[model samples]
Target: MSLELESASVEQTQEIAQQIARLVEPGDVILLNGDLGAGKTHFTQGLAAGLETPTVPTSPTFNIMFVYEGGRLPLYHFDLYRLEDADELEDIDYYGTIEGDGVSVVEWADKFEDAQPDECLAITIRILPDQTRVLSLEPYGGHFEDIVAAIA
Candidate 1:
């Protein structure tokens, strides 16, 4: 099942993400899907704050991935927009990191189906006509299902 929520502003989007952050644990994978300028980074920023990460997070568009430590758990932020194909995931050790002791958040994850885990929390942010955002949260496994229930 999917839970739908609305955000009237960028701050609201981040606030909603912070709510999810509280329930996250090590080895959690969050797949983020959204269009350009759809507030994906903003949501991630809030997640980092909720996790108590020392530094703020920026989009890893050019770098592809950014690893932030010194928080409740490590944050492995990834952007797959630059990748031409799913084969490049291996070059970045994508699978290894996501399965590591950290919470993995992948932006533009829909770009490559192979990168998606069988069990994860997948979120899609849609831009509404009024410039607001509609976020749909879907859980793919039992753990994620519990999270969605708590956040819903």
Candidate 2:
């Protein structure tokens, strides 16, 4: 199953993010694919809220990943936009971190399309004219599919 939401404002987009965030649990991977200023981080803010604690920081464009603890689950936020080599993932313990602690949310995760992920939820945000936006989601694997079905 899938969901397409028309967001009228940035807050609505964050609300959408929060809704999905609430459904997330540990051992989950979320790939947020979209262009810059496309509300990916805005949605992530909502996820932070769902984590039951919130955070504000610049994008991890150079830092790679930032781990926020003290939520219902640990939230690992990764922005892979600056990565030049795929092997660098090993240095960061990429896939290994997905199931070990809290949920892993990767912005610009399309780089890992070949390596996809187990139980990964892919969210694609598209911008339109008139300040409107489209949010598309595909939840893969058993647990993530259950997340989709539950939302449906």
Candidate 3:
């Protein structure tokens, strides 16, 4: 399933994220695709809010990943933007992370498509000339089809 949503402001973008977060389950993988300054981190912050995480969310660009607890489920946030290849994924135990008892959101996931699970939710954010954002959600398998349908 596929969906297209428009967010005219940062708050709207985050609100949309929260709506999706409400439906997340453990072991779910969310792939975020967009260029720099596309509000990926902001969306993540919204997810954290919906998950009831106490810690504030931040971009994992330099650290590669960050773990947030104190929520309904833990959040394993990953930023693969700086990685050279999927080989680096092993260093971070990428597969293991996503398989854990929490939800995983990967930024710059387009870089390592092969490493992504077949049943993940992929969100692509496009910036328009008016500074609005167009978020396109694509579900790779039946697991995410319901989510896309509900959020759409």
Which prediction has the highest lDDT against the true structure? Answer: 3
lDDT (Cα, tens digit) per residue for candidate 1, span 1-152: 78999999888988888888899988999999999999889989989988999989999999999999999999999999999988899999999999999999999999997769999999999999999899999999998999889988
User: Of models 2 and 3, which has the larger TM-score?
Assistant: 3
Q: What stretches of model 1 exceed 4 Å from their correct place?
A: none
User: 26, model 1: CA deviation in Å?
Assistant: 1.0
How well is each residue in 1-152 modelled by candidate 2, as lDDT tens digits? 77677898888988877777788877888899988888887887778887876565357878999888887888888898888788888889887887677888899999877656856899999998776888888878877778777765
Model 3: residue 6 alpha-carbon error in angstroms? 0.2
Off by over 4 Å in 3: none
Worst 10 residues of 3 by lDDT: 140-149
Q: Where does candidate 2 stray beyond 4 Å?
A: none
TM-score for candidate 1: 0.97
- Candidates in order, TM-scores: namely 0.97, 0.92, 0.98
Q: Which candidate, 1 or 2, has the higher TM-score?
A: 1
lDDT of 2 at 94: 83
- For lDDT, candidate 2 versus 3, the one ahead is 3
- Candidate 3 structure, TM-score to reference: 0.98
Clashing residue pairs in candidate 1 (N, C-alpha, C atoms within 3 angstroms)? none
For candidate 3, what is the lDDT? 0.94
